[model samples]
Target: MLDIDEFTPGTGSYEWHLSGDRLLWSKGLLAVYGLTQAPDRGEGFFTSVHPEDRARIRQEMAEVCAKADRFEHRFRIVRPDGRLRFVLDRGVVVRDATGAAVKLSGVETDVTDVVDASTFPAGQGAAPAARGDGRMEEADVIDALFNDAPVGIGIWDRDLRFVKINPLLAEMNGLAPEVHIGKTPKELLPEVVDIDGVTSLLQEILNSGVAKRDVEISGCTPARPSERRFWKEHFFPIRSAGRVSGLAAIVEDVTEARKAQETIDALLHELNHRSKNLVSLILAISRQTARSRPDDFLPVFQSRLESMSAAQDLLVRRSWQDIELEALVRSQLPHFAELIGARIILRGAPDVVIPASAAQSLALAFHELTTNAVKYGALSNEAGKLTIAWQVSADGTGLQIVWRERGGPAVLPPSRKGFGSTLTGAMLQSTLSGEIEADYSSEGLTWSVKFPLNP
Candidate 1:
């Protein structure tokens, strides 16, 4: 148990200034590499990087300092004593007003302890010969792997009784290590002892003395009895006098990995559905624009399509998750972003996230409102002001949005509906599933939109 905290990674900060053509390292960083600053060797600050990793780290750093890309790299380092260690660097590029990358800075962490030494071939990380006789040192290496390795390790006897189990495997089974010492899978978790259980696998390993690889199992553990977790396991026979004795099991928790693949599958399906729907929507908008304004179809259709694209871009960036309402509005009015809080005022809960479909429809509606404001409404004059506000209902299941314009020329309600007018009126109301009110008062045009917010 004391071994759990025996080894810990170290971390430090770094900064590279492009214009100054220099690098700065924190004392903690030098400590992480077990190096002392030579007072006059700033140019050679990064010279300690292993030769094999130098070129790659330099290239990645160049990308961060030139293209302003995020940096996340793992590389090996050599200490003055010739000992090798692994480190991970995470950084971000800083840009100026002209979008020029000016600085690259972030933290670096030592991860030597986490890199399994046993995986390296002999003469590399593996012990030369343990105690000169190699017994004690070999045992220590195996002990380190058993206790400090990220995976779970367990030993089972021929009768499939738990002989020894590490803390990680104990936690996975939701049982203490001692409790599992004499218990079989059926005795501990009979429900999970079905066909996929390890009972037969261990028996086979004991019978044939050949290891069985890549066996997966799923079960509920006391740690989280309600959630069925999964593990990818392997069994290797422990030999005695060239014959099979007990079996050693290496278990890897792959619940999150499986769930991630499942999520990617669902997202792909949704993207497919969304793509087809968007294409159909674009086709409908094109026909409507061409029919309503034959001479001005191109510009009108393009403008509306851009608004839809803006919404889709937001949705795609967030993996089709709910979008920030303010972000959705600002995206549609990108040309007026600088004037957001002044000429174009926004008022609402900043954290209001809206669904993708609602985001798209609302994007179009806001675009139509903005176009009208620019051409014939408040935004057409110097004294005009546009105020947009939204609120969640008392029940928290609905939303109310109001787009009000002030100080514009006298307005009259349109006698015939144009493409923007029809969409914002009947079409938006249908998708929003609530009332849509447009007040074309002599002062200005105010559009009030209400909708149910689906979680």
Candidate 2:
């Protein structure tokens, strides 16, 4: 036999002898079951079970005795005073030398405070299946839904004390159900009650008997004292005998939901801003193209628009976060793919992400450079070559990009500024807050630009 004194103080222990239907209960067991005195060993034990659960307990006990196997059961026991308490009974059958069952010994725990409706037997606290009436008892249905609800639910008396709280509400407050009984919101959530005005709101609901819906509360709770959480709470006045008695509250955690909404709002704002900038840029490009190349205005305008569109496509793909420098270069230079490895060379600080605002201007500058090279510079002949290289500054404050062309024809400085020159020089400087320098040397056309990486 297990030593009753060795078990935890509040838990109950028991032993049952199958031969004579004898039973023994420890002192703790008597206290847990609210028994004033020990009953005749086996006579009164089954009588203490709730009437509805008695038959099932008897059948399960008989099966355990006959099979000589382990048994585990949970049921409600009616205390001497008529209160119903949930308990768990677990034991292993003891066998004799002949392998016949001799006794069963195990422990019992009063789980009334912790048990929820989901653990109740079918048709008791659980939802009823289709049957003769096809309707469940009102009290049972209320009990099932209240305890099994996903959101926090609680009832507070007119005095603002907790009259009843479901497990979900208790857990949200970082307390057990029993601890919440008779406690006010001020006592349970002192840290946040005032900041969120929870107690005042509940009081108002009680006084006015009016319902408050979707009241947002945000603050720290004992459950996570250091972390802030948000809840959307609905408060309704509870009425008894046609008079305001208390208040009932349903609370849903909306912390993540609110965060998601903020993210979407930010993205939408960004989209609107970028769309306006794109329109402004397209207008400027059309005006400049028309002024510079009037006879061929449409082709020039279309080419510039296509280059800007490619850059916008890249930004959209990245959620307008940042555009990779290598990706931008590759996208703007697709026309040179055939000569990329042999005659055209690209080298730069790898994996650099350019800011969105600077990406479009830089893409246009690259288009102008490539167009000039194909028309008059190095790329016009098979023997010509082009080299593009870039690097971040040693202090990491800025980036420098160099474009050099060679072997096509002797280079000469433009006698007058054209659209291509203006874009690569003045336009880039104004848009990117950068500096550009061009050298028309006998060897090649060399151009260099320095700009802040972040700006």
User: What would you estimate as the lDDT of candidate 2?
Assistant: 0.79
Cα deviation in Å at residue 128, candidate 1? 18
Residues 21-89, candidate 2: write the lDDT tens digits.
Answer: 787788878887888665666658978887777777777777887885666667778888888777766
Each model's TM-score, in the order given? 0.62, 0.70
Best by TM-score: 2
- CA-lDDT, candidates in order: 0.77, 0.79
Candidate 1 lDDT over 161-198, as tens digits, reads 66557779888888766456445667777656363446
Among all candidates shown, the one with the greatest lDDT: 2
> Any residue pairs clashing in model 2, and if so which?
none
RMSD of each: 20.6, 8.1
Stretches of candidate 2 off by over 4 Å are 1-140, 191-196
